[model samples]
Target: MALTGAASAPPRLAPGGVVTRADALLAALRAAAPDPARLPRDAGALLGERAALAGLRRNGRIAAGGRARLLCAADGWIAVQLARPDDVALLPAWLEVDPARFEGDPWPALAAAVRDRAAVPLVARARWMGLPAAAAGGGSAEGGAPGMDAKPPLAEARRAGDAPPSAAEARPADGAPPRVEAPPALRVTQAGTPRRRHAGPWRVLDLSSLWAGPLATHLLAGLGARVAKVESTARPDGARRGPAAFFDLLQAGKESVALDFRAPAGREQLRRLVAWADLVVESARPRALAQLGLDAEALLAEHPGLSWLSITGYGRPEPGGGWVAFGDDAAVAGGLVARDDDGAPLFCGDAIADPLAGLHAAWAALGALRAGGGRLLDVSLAGVAAEAAAGGVDPRACVVADAGGARVLCAGRSARVAEPRARRPAGRARDLGADTTALLREARA
Candidate 1:
């Protein structure tokens, strides 16, 4: 058996909350399903969306602590994500959908059918683009997992480093007339296709090196998008060696294009791809993209509907914005490093912030697209690490020290708790004192 997606299935019910995959899936399936009066066209859209949602939700609550809603097209290709900033684990699964299946205008009935087939329950009233109620199993109403959350079509058709598309292909989804006016900033464009709409597949220009940045486009690849992972031969991706760990994990469904963006021609070629991209994601430091001539303003002027994401250690224009730093786990442990009285530093065991922040960038990009809103996503590793510790106390504050001893720190606090044995009781000492007194008197005589 394929071990139905749940690992140690969460309890059917939890207190201070109502979380049950079965119920949420079932409810979403029922609500999003089209009625003759509502959806009018194909019901299959709803079904497919529901099925994909069930699969994405199956992983249950991830360590970052949030649930995700999967948007699917009839062909089993997931189109978008409705995950919150905290739900980072959903990216991999989201990236797995085929691009050929995206529907810019999704069918309500089809989404419902998919839900029914997957046996996923739904929580009612989830709506997007005037669509019916829908819900991913664990999302809550207000935000975060255990609540309400909001939430790809692909076309391959292209390998990495393909020549960029013409100006027409780079237009935004705003339906505005093309403008000939030039802007002071970099020249750019954006494009966004809605669910259930039969739009041609697109290529992604990925200007990220490591796990967090490239991971977004890697996901885009899984859904049938052609992701050209842009790298520089001068600065190779860290994943190329680090256990070759993230290379496969992040680039699973994508192709790579190593380019020297620092060179003049590289910028022109990149602009061609930018003109061709429906979306662009970067893990560069703040203003770094602009230096390379790929900032949001430049891109949006040419392609207004384009969705852009900027994943970073801190944030652009914020304190420490451009300062390069470690991923979430490393930064957190380093920031909170608790030195023993001996002055030795200790760190946490997980590298959590990178992936969590990466996933948030991915989810936000998709959400903005679905809503037809183009904006820059400023995701920070430190911010995400802080979120992981939410609702919990700081460990350092309550730490207890041990008493001085030969015991190794491994013994923990036992050195402090132990007390030395007391001297013999007064009664036993009295006899010894009397003997001493008699000896003294004899000597005197």
Candidate 2:
């Protein structure tokens, strides 16, 4: 289903039509699954899982989750996500304010600081400092125009040693002279015969935290994959501090193995766990894992039948690989925000990018596995949001005002703009490290 048009005020779900898109992808996934019943029936509903638990709502300049805000800059609006304490701590530095004077909440000071600054420089500075920030409507540090068409690809994949085509080497689809260089959206890093050998459920080693990665693996688990989630003993998933039901919904069926990455024995156990899986899912920056001596390329090379799914904010490409992002800001970077009556940007859903990326990542991982593993699937939150926005609003879709607020009418079917709902957890999620000892003992055996 498409979002309502511009002639009237679009409902809160207008901008990305992400729920509709996710529903389509989910349907395709179920069609390809060995057991269609294993997958969830409503992809659109999954997008609102977190909101359902957190009780979030759509606020024009403020994100539904209330952690990110769209503040005005001298040139345009920019989204700054203070989702973490570290992000809040960096505010004084980001705004060039005196730490001694900065007190209480940072939003007022932040809003005042950026009121006279240009968005491009502010965004560039925030990214350099590792803050999750982005210009409204897809503007970047490179000065790209703010529009849906100018947004970067939802995700780009590349093999080792691959580079963007030179202008001279590129060609337009219309058979005209090459105007600009562009990198391929996806490329097979390695080819292998399709591994139709499904003697048992696929084993998945999940080394991701929070929403995107965990949600992907959770979906895989729902499809009968045996998933083992690995978390650091010192730093368990931050989600544990949030709503219990939300955390349980994403982690219900997985075995938890907490390891101390700083210790040699722990790292060894991690390597063994990696060896034990047919697929590995992670969301760390490209270099973060390499620093831990767990490189994707090296692991893929060693395990020719392994499939690795890497979820990131931007992607693994050079400059973007170094940037930090969260769901709200990343959605802004992807041009996925709804437009207000004055054409200003508004946060559409509750950290919408996370679920969108999660769904896409799960789908991509399954495809790679079906193709016989030996591949790295790089899925980015911003990239997926951009792709969703690229589909544009469906002209046939319209919003009908009703006594209960608003309902979206599309293709002769109407759905109410209701509160997001959570799914029943398949089972209780195991405590952190609950399976570490047993799994490690089995690995040794």
The CA root-mean-square deviation of candidate 1, after full C-alpha superposition on the true structure, stands at 30.6
Backbone clash total, candidate 1: 61
> Across residues 37-57, which tens digit of lDDT does each residue of candidate 2 receive?
767888767888787787765
Alpha carbon lDDT of each predicted model: 0.36, 0.72
Identify the runs in model 2 with alpha carbons over 4 angstroms from their true place: 1-10, 138-188, 191-199, 395-400, 409-415
Give the per-residue lDDT of model 1 (tens digit) for 1-445. 0111122432111111111222332343334333312211222222122123223222222211122223322221111223223122222222223433333322342344343221111110011011111112221211111211111000133222333232123222442211111101111123333222125554466777655666556444534555556666576665564433225545544545555668997676667666656667777765667788776755665565566677665445432243344442222311211122232212211233454455455555555555553555666654443443222222222223333422212223422212111111112111112222332232234
TM-score quality measure for candidate 1? 0.43
Candidate 2 displacement at residue 296 in angstroms? 0.7
lDDT of 1 at 244: 32
Compute the lDDT of residue 245 as modeled in candidate 1: 27
